[model samples]
Target: MPIKLADIAIFIITLAIIVFYSVTTLQKDSNSSYAKIEIDGNTFIYPLEKDLIKTFHGPIGDTTIEIKNGKISITESDCKNKICIKMGKIDKLGQAVACLPNKLLITIEGESNDEVDILSY
Candidate 1:
């Protein structure tokens, strides 16, 4: 079998794409951020810098969220699986924990004015 230049180019392109995605996914924002909670269709936004506890009631029951030391986590939930609670804490922008049965989602969001310098990517 003979190696072809076209095959080498395709492999290089694929490797570049994989590296790009991996770098983007592994990077976490260090700037100040916020936490967003979505229940049903309504969304509640909170600053991640604040320390507070919130409980949201849904058709199933209550879901407890706690934000402390710039980290947010689902401390309690009435859902049967308890997967949301197992998601642990999230402090970086774009991290999320969701409860499908209760239609609840908690996501980390950063300020829009945050500069996207070379280091950010």
Candidate 2:
């Protein structure tokens, strides 16, 4: 079958729309100033400006997190798959890494703001 001009125009428009939305949804690293660690319902806040290493104890085992040069990463974990550690560093606002097996969650957040955007049932 031969392609028509209408189909080419539609394809270009769709590709442009996808790129625009994806680029607009990205969070800039400059707005990310700190990291929030939530472990077993306990919350710990740390600044990204400083370099430090901390370990949290979870139901499964210990999980080690590191913050250096304005980025945070899961350096070590006792989780079976170690998927969290493999996720690497994140320095953008709203970026997160989760060790589900260890019940640990780390998210890069901006300055003080207390607003719930979404809730799960």
Candidate 3:
């Protein structure tokens, strides 16, 4: 079958969308960054520039996180599947890794600002 006008239009639209998303995702901020760790009801924030290792307790067991070279990763965990540890490292803003069984979440975030967003409400 021959290509139709609609097919070309759709291809162009899809290519444009892919290009737009790629450009936006590649932009990185220069602001200071941190890793926000949350387990149960407690929250902890640590600077990404600092290298450290910390373990937190959850309902199941302990989850250890490590920060090195401005990136963070789940270095150890008691969760059976260990998918969290396999998640590797994250250093970009808004990247996250979670261990659902341990009720743990680690998110990469930038410096806080005075402006409020929808989540703050």
Q: How many clashes would you count in candidate 2?
A: 0
lDDT of 1 by residue, 1-121 (tens): 7989999999999999999999977776456688989997899999888999999997799999999998999999999999999999998666789888889999877764255333345
RMSD of each: 14.3, 13.1, 13.5
Error of 1 at 89 (Å): 0.2
If ranked by lDDT, best first, what sequence of candidates would result? 3, 1, 2
Return whichever of 1 and 2 wins on TM-score.
1
- Of the candidates shown, which would achieve the greatest lDDT relative to the real structure? 3
Put down candidate 3 lDDT per residue, 17-121, tens digits, no spaces. 999999877765345788899999999999999999999999999999999999999999999999999999998777899998999999877754323223334
How displaced is residue 7 in candidate 3, in Å? 72
Candidate 3: list runs displaced more than 4 Å: 1-29, 112-121
lDDT of 2 by residue, 1-121 (tens): 8999999999999999999888866744344478999999999999899999999999989999999998999999998999999999987767789999999999877753333213211
Please state the error at residue 4 of candidate 2 in Å: 81
In angstroms, how far off is 33's CA in candidate 3? 0.6
The lDDT for every candidate, in the order shown, is: 0.86, 0.85, 0.87
